[model samples]
Target: MQRNTLGNTGLEVGPLCIGTSTLAGFTETYGYDVDDERAVETVLAVFDSEVNYLDTGNNYGKDGLAERRVGEAIRRRGGLPEGFVLQTKVDADPVTGDYSGARVRRSLEESLERLGVDHLPVLALHDPEFMSADQDGFGPGGALEALVAIRDEGIADHLAVASGSVEVTQRYLDTGAFDVVLNHNRFTLLNREAQDLFEGARDKGLGVLNAAPYGGGMLVKGPAQQPKYCYGERDEAFAASALAMAEACEAAGVPLAAAALQFSTRSPLVDSTVVGISRPERIRETLALLAVEIPPALWVELESLRPDARI
Candidate 1:
């Protein structure tokens, strides 16, 4: 896997980043449970693979279980692999809903403790939209200030904005505090909502990561299997288009998963694509998907069905 410059952060990472949300056993969301053994093995496999990036979040599981699982793998391996880039996020308090400056600093401390590491390559502010306007996440003595202080203190080398909403993320970006910007379920084959946001970030020299290329599984599993788009109510027109693309992929002797995964990996504006994996075999499958060749005609057909315009 070839590594590239991640904006101006000065860290090199492969195009594919392993996501640990599923590894945390978020069965309610991903519809499956991943035991600790499985989760640690998967992370170990990732460390030995060509890919050099991994992403996690503070609230990914019950009491930050995901970070602990990844940390277990690191402990077994003695330390992180050379040149590997690991990033995690800060979330509002699960019980108190506190997203204050104090909470922000504590979140990084907690994540570091869970991951069994002293430092992080990147620390992101996750789901700022969930924090109330006056929740102390932006002004002085707020989350943003805390994150900047963490970076300045050399606890986290870089800061990032990670959110599901473009508006909320842009609000943080406008503060000019982040070196990377990550968004999920927005720039996939069915949705181009983050296209403009990512393009602008690249222009500003910020690393951009596009996550959930399968639109939360509908594109890869077929609308019949995954029924929803972006893990929510199905968009009727988008579902119909997904069906058409699935059929076209069948005719082209290609798996829809390949097109979906490559869609983000092939984009020029994206520095990395984050993919959730629970099993080690999934990594092998991902490599095979990356190797699958898509015909030009197939791209033409898929593009015809893509969100006619960025919605």
Candidate 2:
């Protein structure tokens, strides 16, 4: 429940951030639907709990439905709790798929409208890899330009770079333009692709947010329930590697989910770990997992697996 300052952003947030993609009912993508009542309950539960930060995106639903759902919860509460921070993202146009400077501000405006807030303490560029830097996102009249302008205009307190690829994330971080950097499905136990990126961001004093510690739900559900990696179908090797880790966890008397959630938090370079939650009970479960202590021997055996090196 203790809060950590998210790098130079001057905002103190809980180590666990509530991710809202599941609340948007992106069933096709997230594998489940959370109705509005359930979404509001989950948001309020996390906010009322020790967790104090919530993350959503502009394109998280059919038409920014995720932001709207979070906004509804905020409105119902009359405002966010003291010290609570709300974060969202901007990127290519949902309709036109154009990643332009105009789209950047327009997206923020749309997100603000959906979230029912005037300003955001945190806003990130959703995915720069999808936007050719030279042509759209990092150029003169691109998304970054507009994001900086908005930050200077006091519309957003801080800007962040959120991407799935290390190369793309580093490309944005190299510019020294973001206050925070978020890499998803890369720094998990099964993948160390973002290890260097996390180090680089910490060196530059930028906040680092590691998301999807479960590796697209593999560490949480195993290959039997979900045989996917980074949202795509995984091969036999990937499944076998996950099975090995699960067996080791079982032997060590630790839950795979507990190890997965703590893996990111244990890193001194990681400022926050964002986790997606659907039901209110899931929030309680995650908090309990965060409290569970994994034995050193378990870590030793899990390290021997080296799924990142193999798969």
The CA lDDT of each predicted structure is: 0.89, 0.86
Give the lDDT of residue 67 in candidate 2: 90
lDDT of 1 by residue, 1-311 (tens): 77878999989988899898877777756667989999999999999899899999999999999999999999999999998899999999999888999999888889999899999998999989899766867788899999999999999999999889999899899889999999999998778899999989998999998888888778877888777787677677778888888888999999999999999998999889999888888888998898899998998888888756423
Question: 41-122, model 2: which lDDT tens digit per residue?
Answer: 8888876788889999998887898898898889888888888889999968876788889888888989999888999999
Would you estimate the TM-scores of all the predictions? Answer: 0.96, 0.96
* Runs in model 2 lying further than 4 Å from the true structure: 132-134, 308-311
Give, for candidate 2, the lowest lDDT window spanning 10 residues: 130-139
- Provide backbone clash counts, one per model: 0, 0
| Candidate 2: Cα lDDT at 293 | 84
In terms of lDDT, which candidate is strongest? Answer: 1
